[model samples]
Target: PAFTLESLDGVPVSLEGLRGRPVVLNFWASWCGPCREEAPMFRELSARQGSGDGLAVVGILFQETNEQSARDFIREYALAYPNLKDPRIDTGVEYGVSGIPETVFIDAEGVVQHMDRGGLTRERLNVGLEKIGVPAL
Candidate 1:
């Protein structure tokens, strides 16, 4: 179930490309209520984490209608991280995401450290960050 999904802006993003870093892979949809609720928190965490220091916040758009919808969602939330489109949903299947707003924390060694199946708060996100060997937001 390995994938190299393209970002809204057409940038290629892959797990292999982000090998050395701890990854926060969030599966969400524009139309999902819980996903909307946690979008801002994800944005804040992405801003705080940036793309340096061996950490990455990657948004995997699931069950989204179109690229424009995903782009609009990202713009509305002011998200700085890459939002990748999982059209076939194979990536989501591999991650066992049964619903929107699921999150997977992958450690530096490419191990799945934590899996959360709902909207995330700053506190819960901090715990996941800690589990993946990163500083809390």
Candidate 2:
């Protein structure tokens, strides 16, 4: 599903705007333990967003009532990707999210390539990226 959610600072992050690149769309909540565990790995991958990989990492805050907590989490993790606001979890609903930490990988053509639920590991994340045609780095 296509969507445009605003960052904590109100900057719009649109799925369609990230065309021509593979996308990593993560749905997570600040209070989630699994989300916390994967934040740093995501932070690392976020740095590769605009490189030759032409990949984009984006986060959709799911079921998080406190915007400040989300902001603090981003700050603490030093995440480089765009973390968008989804106060009502609307985007999650569209994606059939039954739990936090669900990640969807989209190809350069904007086609959904893979989906992973629960925690993400380096191996699993690499596998997902592989499906989207991202090379090992």
Highest lDDT, which number? 2
Query: In candidate 2, where is summed lDDT lowest over 10 consecutive residues?
Result: 44-53
For model 1, the local distance difference test gives 0.87
Q: Which lDDT values do the candidates have, in the order given?
A: 0.87, 0.91
TM-scores across all candidates? 0.93, 0.96
Weakest lDDT window of 10 consecutive positions for candidate 1: 44-53
Best candidate, TM-score: 2
lDDT score, candidate 2: 0.91
Per-residue lDDT tens digits for candidate 2, residues 1-137, read 89999998889989899999999999988899999999998998988876888999999999998888998999999987889998778889998888989999999999999999999988999999999999753
Per-residue error (Å), model 2, residue 55: 0.4
Off by over 4 Å in 2: none
Query: How far is 136's C-alpha from truth in model 1 (Å)?
Result: 1.2
Residue 137, candidate 1: alpha-carbon lDDT: 79
Name the regions of candidate 1 deviating beyond 4 angstroms: 50-52
